[model samples]
Target: MNKQLIFFFLFVLFIIYSFSVYFSGTTYDKGISHFTTEAKLGKKLFQEKNCISCHQIYGLGGYMGPELTNIISYRDNDESIARAFLKGGTAKMPNFQLNDEEIDALISYLKYIDKAGNYPPKAYEITPYGTVNEIVTDEK
Candidate 1:
């Protein structure tokens, strides 16, 4: 009888855990799909160039370079980003020698990503136990 009761309690706990995980919501921007031809090409270019090996989009890539989530916002427009790409990156970043069309596609993809959501999560709530939680806020 005791074993049966323990099993029942464990089963209930598992069910609750599963439900919580299912409803936790996703961090990705569902609206940001690479459906357009330019966006798709840009995504391909990004992968071909191995950008993820250094820069991060939505904070999921490598740590070698800075996170590129809100790069457009920081530059205030796409022209700055295009210029940076044209001029090649800093000492750490190599020149891609991408053509004007390729650059345009890449910029389009970046703009889409920028419109999707913010990154580095500005609003953080610090708990008494030193645990930091991300607080989503409206963009200004």
Candidate 2:
């Protein structure tokens, strides 16, 4: 009887856990699919150029370049700063010799990505349960 009761309790806990997990929803942005025409072109260009080899987004790409996830916001939303870099290139960065239209498209894509999220999250707490909880705010 005790074994049966324990099994029944475990079954109830499993059902509750499954329901909670199903209703929690996803943390990803739903608007990610809605990119502008220019941004879409930029995404294609980004893949074609293999920019991930030198740069990272959300800390998932190469470490040779700085993470670009929040670069637009970090640069005070100055598209010109990024434009100049792409136009002339830096000492560490090679000049891709991209035309004006290509550069603009890339900038637009970066702007769209910037709106997605931040890297190295602003605030996070490490729980005693060995889980990290991100504290989201409306600062942006």
**Which candidate comes out best when scored by lDDT?**
2
In model 2, which runs have C-alpha deviations exceeding 4 angstroms?
A: 1-34, 124-140
Clashes of each: 0, 0
Task: List all candidate RMSDs to the true structure.
Answer: 7.0, 5.4
Candidate 1 — which pairs collide? none
Best by TM-score: 2
- TM-scores for all candidates: the values are 0.60, 0.66
Cα lDDT tens digits, model 1, 38-58, are 977988999999989988998
How far residue 81's Cα lies from its native spot in candidate 1, in Å, is 3.6
Put down candidate 2 lDDT per residue, 1-140, tens digits, no spaces: 59999999999999999988877765445337537899999999999988899999878998888899878878788888888988998998889999999998999889878777577658888999999987865333
Q: Cα lDDT for residue 52, model 1? A: 91
